[model samples]
Target: MMTIMRNTKLSTRTAAKEASHERIVCVAARAIRRSGYDGTGVADIMKEAGLTHGAFYAHFASREAMLAEAAGRACAEAAAAAADGVASVPPEQALTYMFHAYLSRENLEQVERGCPLAALASETARQTPEVRRVSTRYIKEMVDLVARQSPDWGQPGSHERALVSVATMVGTLLLARIADEPALSDSLRAAALQHLPVA
Candidate 1:
């Protein structure tokens, strides 16, 4: 009975630790997107998560580790959200939905729930190799997911088109976010929406 109780205690401890880790990641993910990876700090994440600063090291190896995991989590969440938007529409219209959904004013304004690709992409090259690796992995996943929705999917050039579309979309979002004037931002989004190969 003592051994069984000890085992149960161990399981409970493990589960609690995992939950804490997940909470940290969830908080950090929003922090990273709202403020660039470099702008997000451990204290901010811990505080946002309602966790004490000292408890952070117990959950993650370091700030970079948290950022890497958070970036992966953020990217995966964004992609899944986009994929769901695509799935609701017909295949031929999937890319159109993706384009508008991604370029939507709501998406652009919702920094807390926006795309990690658009937020951290330019900064990835300067980040730790691990962070860059995680970003690359998710970007590839997004491109593949987008490719699947393209009208020419399975054709020789479909992937290339998807790559261009993803690149254009990210660039557009970046420019829109950086623009000082709302009109310029709207123009940037509108131009990309009209010119990009969404169909």
Candidate 2:
């Protein structure tokens, strides 16, 4: 009976630790996106997660390890969200919907909660290989998602087209966000939307 009791206590402690770990990762994911990887700090993430600073090491081996996991989480969430949006519309309208939604002003202003690709693009090249690996994996998934949305998905040039589309969308969002003038931002988005292939 004593052994069983100890086992139960162990399980309970493990579960609680897992929950705290999840909370920290969740907070870190959003923080990395809202603030660049360099801008995000370990103490800030722990504080925001409502956990003590000292407890962070109990969950992750190092800051880069945590950042890698956070980057993966952020990418997965963004891909899932984009896939959900695509699934909600008719087959013929999926690409159009994606283009407009991605380039929308709301997405532009919501940098903290927006696409991590655009949010972190300026700093990604300098990130650790682990973080870059996570980013690269999701980038391919995103390109595939966009390509699959194309009517000529399996046909020649489809992948290329999707590549261009994703690149344009990301670039447009970056430029729009960089522009201080509201009119310039609006025009940049409008121009990108006009060029995007509409179904």
Candidate 3:
């Protein structure tokens, strides 16, 4: 009976530790998305997560370790969201759905919870080797997804179209974030969507 009770207590502790780790990742992801990679710090993430700085080391080896995991989580969430948008649409309409969803005003205003690549892509180019590699893989995955939805194009054109589409979406969102006027943000989205190839 004592052994059984001790095992139960250990299981509860393990479960609680796992839950705390998940919460840390969730809070870190949100902060990184809202404040860019370089802008966010370990202390801030821990404080925001209601965990202590020392406790962070218990969960992750370093800030970069957490960043890589957070980036992966963010990518997965974005991919799921994008997939949700395209799941019900026909293959031909996939581009329309993706482009429109990506360039939407709501997405633009919610960068903290939007596409991970677009949110910290510029900073990603300068990330640690592991982070850059993961970012590269994420980009390739997105391109493949777009290609799957665009079967009408030739091989070269398919790849080109995917690249162009992603580039346009990311570029437009970045520019929109920088522009001083709300109209300019709207114009950026309009121009990108208007110029994209449609089926």
* Winning candidate number (lDDT): 2
Stronger candidate by TM-score (1 vs 3): 1
Tell me model 3's lDDT, rounded to 2 decimals.
0.85
True-structure RMSD, every candidate: 1.2, 0.9, 1.5
Error of 1 at 34 (Å): 0.9
Which 10-residue span in candidate 3 carries the lowest summed lDDT?
Answer: 147-156
Ten contiguous residues with the weakest lDDT in model 1: 116-125
Candidate 2 vs 3: which has more TM-score: 2
C-alpha local distance difference test of each model = 0.89, 0.93, 0.85
What is candidate 1's lDDT per residue for 1-199, written digit by digit as tens?
9999999999999999899899999988898888888899999888888889999989888898899899888988998898789889888888888899999999999887889988877888899988889888888987898889877789999999888888999999999999999999999999999998866
Order of the predicted models by TM-score, top scorer first: 2, 1, 3
The deviation in Å at residue 27 for candidate 2 is 0.5
lDDT of 3 by residue, 47-130 (tens): 988888889988998899999888888887888888888897887788898999889989988988998787897899888887
**How far out, in Å, is residue 80 in model 1?**
0.9
Q: On a 0 to 1 TM-score scale, where does candidate 3 land against the true structure?
A: 0.93
Candidate 1 pairs with clashing backbones: none
How far out, in Å, is residue 57 in model 3? 0.8
